[model samples]
Target: MVQEIRWGIVGLGSIAHTFAKDLALVTGGTLTAVASRSLEKAKAFAGEYGVAHTFDTYDALFESKEVDVVYIATPHTSHEALSIRAMENGKHVLCEKPMGVNPDQVARMIAVAEKNKVFLMEALWSRFNPSIRKAKQLVESGEIGSVGFVHADFAFYALNRDPDNRLLNPDLAGGSLLDIGIYPIFLSYLLLGMPKNIQASSHLYKTGVEMQTSMIFDYEGAQAILYSGLNSKSEMKAEISGSEGSIFLSPRWHEAQGYSIEKEGELVDYNLPTKGKGYTYEIEEVHSCLASGKVQSSMWSHRNSVDLARLLYEVRQKSNIIFPFEQQKEGV
Candidate 1:
């Protein structure tokens, strides 16, 4: 019999709600506890998930022995501190994407994870996504011989969103680059590895946060054209083209349910539906790693996260995007 891995979630935001719902669809793991700054919010979330514990403060939950692992689902600005505290408290951590506001923060989080000797992973659900995985496998197997180009984009209109919203608020490190841009960037890195040279440009919102970013990642003989924006809706399609064929992840490709392969002038499609809201796959990955006594997932290692952070930070630097918290580090 497998022992159930106890799961706790911090931050009861919209994404957290989605994650909690998907957690129900996973097996060998149970939502043991939930924490929020507001006791009412914690209790409400706990009631919905049948979580055994609820804490008004994150520190309270971190202190509780009931939680074996904590999922940090808060905004990008809070990920570093929350995750470090959880690891320091002897709890494993699965933090949401982008992991931190900058490479420095991410390094701090990783250092704490290493020092604590606890499991830590950036919850990049797409890395564990079935369709994305198949596409990567096909590329690796030479189905897409000698990759030459990769293009992906994720965008949706949020310019109308109030300035106070995290999507536009510089205080929360809000922007298209860190929020949606990471998806396309992740795809580029997954298939193409690091770029030798890069070119990037970003359009800023009224709030001083970037609303749009376009990037060109240059590899040895390959290039990836990526774009993300909050000013308009994008096609949300992603394609990886090589000398022989191309792999097309369908619309809204980040969480694509299917993918197509075009080879020898023929296109073949494959359906690989996710179990629930896509978070279930990542939840299962966490379960597997914990069961195996692994500190990081092979699918998305800590090095991968660090590399991704560096890429993000570099892009921000090239595009002149800086969060309020990082301005001091920038000597501004």
Candidate 2:
């Protein structure tokens, strides 16, 4: 068994930095290498993290014999290509959420992983969060008494950011749907499973990027109301209601530190704080899977990622959401 798991991080962006910081907190993983299109960026990040190697290109990083796995933190559009290349080089991958731009892209990534016989998992950290996991247990134990409805929204005001930034740049697959919207959808799927039907609406900015989206997922006997936005800020809370009581997740619920359950007019809150931005939990999961020779995480498997991508693409279809590149490719 490979006792010490070596990690290489591609993309020296904010999320990558956060993940790298948490990787240090993991027991068996070491940040041995870093990579980016810019060597200076990679070197700077490596220096801060006490990393030993830096690669100017992802190909160099994936070809590294030292790195057992890699974390892909680049833009949404690059996830498929980067992950395919990494897996082809025999490096396990822990990709950032949404997995890909759509279900098709995600499927292709999975096929490559299978062909390479390497572990691959979407870094949907919320699925492994302590508080969220507890909530799942509570709900499954009938603490919530058969879920009837779910409500979650993740939003923030980012209109002032540069138009070219990822949040607003259509070229980078920018949109509220693929970014923050996936969280609410994931919560719904986690608790309620796939919906029987979906109703959605979206608002777009002048640059053709989706600014906000509203979704209604209909299950057999339950429903989920979800939203995501960048034009304005929201409470970022989440709620799940059942016949006997209601469960509430704190603001910024995706990374919620605590949650409450209300039964018969009495509300009880529970605190389950995360360790190191909550990415540590998923990092540990990847380590466990790799150590055991597993090709996917049981918690957030490839199937879950594909389903989430399908939900996203479905919402886009119903809401008439289309990106510039997609339109061009389709010759619209």
lDDT of each residue in 77-133, candidate 2, tens digit only: 999999999999999999998789988899999999999999999989999988888
TM-score against native, each model: 0.98, 0.98
Q: So what's the TM-score on candidate 2?
A: 0.98
Q: Score residue 99 of candidate 1 by CA lDDT.
A: 93
Candidate 1, poorest ten consecutive residues by summed lDDT: 323-332
Tell me which residue pairs clash in candidate 2: none
Q: Compared with the true structure, what per-residue lDDT tens digits does model 1 show for residues 215-281?
A: 9999999999999999999999999999999999999899999999998989999899989889999
Per-structure clash totals for the candidates? 0, 0
Task: Estimate the overall C-alpha local distance difference test score of candidate 2.
Answer: 0.92
Backbone clashes in model 1, listed as residue pairs: none
